[model samples]
Target chain A: GESVGLHLPTLSVQEGDNSIINCAYSNSASDYFIWYKQESGKGPQFIIDIRSNMDKRQGQRVTVLLNKTVKHLSLQIAATQPGDSAVYFCAENKGGSQGNLIFGKGTKLSVKP
Target chain B: DVKVTQSSRYLVKRTGEKVFLECVQDMDHENMFWYRQDPGLGLRLIYFSYDVKMKEKGDIPEGYSVSREKKERFSLILESASTNQTSMYLCASSLGGSRADTQYFGPGTRLTVL
Candidate 1:
């Protein structure tokens, strides 16, 4: 069965430190990938995305790296803040499908001041 | 601003009860989806509609049915709610494209079936 999963279930970091969350996807046909952040009591918010043709994409305070050869993805956040503490998910778009995202089990990131 | 809205924030139902979950997108997206978010399981697709009156069953669609009478609205129906159905339901929409596009999500509905 095709599945997307995370390597870590939870992580704790000090404020101002860098945070990295990892994901592994099983579908070789997936070409588009995205990262989302979900805060308490809120829906998941789009963070950043990377295409299969590229290996890296950067955003405001986040970066997404895709390793298609290893079928792995990772999200990196700089200057982690308390507000950055949330559940982060990695999702992949299956090729040939019309915008259907398959998500991975999220990694809970906790930032301590 | 593009927004997806769900009818309920929270719902409680008994086993065997019929459940209705409604979602609307203001972005006029060509595609809409329904998913259940459970701890450790992530978001599992229940169903999706690419156009009005058309739908496709997703990974977990056995106990659920869908209706897309209008382009902006999609509804999920549970013929007989079960305890296993208790989870956070999320609705999302995206512009129709060749590959999976970035989806805008709704607040979500927490359902509890007892």
Candidate 2:
């Protein structure tokens, strides 16, 4: 089945370090991708997004990279803080419909202060 | 900001009981979605409503039904809840067209089926 998934289930990073989360999507038809951050006891919050036409997009402290050739995506966070510790998810628009998205399992990122 | 609100933060229901989960979005989005989040499985779409009184089954719609009487309100119904139905329920809304891919989610409802 065509789906999106993460390469790592958990990650540990030191404060002030840069962290990168990886995702692999199998659907070739997916054009738009997004990253989300979900803290404990809260819902998922939009992080950043990248379109198939672009290779990278930057956020306040985050960056999303898309590789359409390898169908890979990554989120990079600079100066990782304790508040940056959360489960990160990557999503792809559902089969070009643009009305729905298929989310990946997730990667738990822990910042060690 | 897009505000999506669920009816409950936590709910407990017995097996075989009918359960109702309500979601309201103030953004006047034309698209609403219901999803179940479980360990390992991630967020599986249960159903979605594109317009008032219009619905489309998602990837996983069995044992779940939905109603969208109004544009802003969407409801998910569990005909007969079972232990397997225990999971976190998430509701989201989107602009419903070219921009619908960007969705705003609610806090979520943690439902436990006993």
Per-model RMSD to reference: 2.5, 2.5
Q: Best candidate, TM-score-wise? A: 2
Write candidate 1's Cα lDDT for B1-114 as tens digits: 789999999999999999999999998899999999876677899999999999999999999999999999999999999999999999999988665789889999999999
**Taking the tens digit of each residue's C-alpha lDDT, what string does model 2 give over A40-87?**
878899888887889999989898988888889999999999999989
Candidate 2 B-chain TM-score: 0.97
Q: lDDT tens digits, residues A1-113, model 1?
A: 11235343788999999999999887898998989899876789888889899999888988888898999999999999999998888889877787888788788899999
Q: Is the docking of candidate 1 incorrect, acceptable, medium or high quality?
A: medium
DockQ of 2: 0.50
RMSD of 1: 2.5
The residue pairs found clashing in candidate 1 are none
- Candidate 1: lDDT of B6? 97
Off by over 4 Å in 1: A1-8
| Reference-based TM-score of each model | 0.93, 0.94
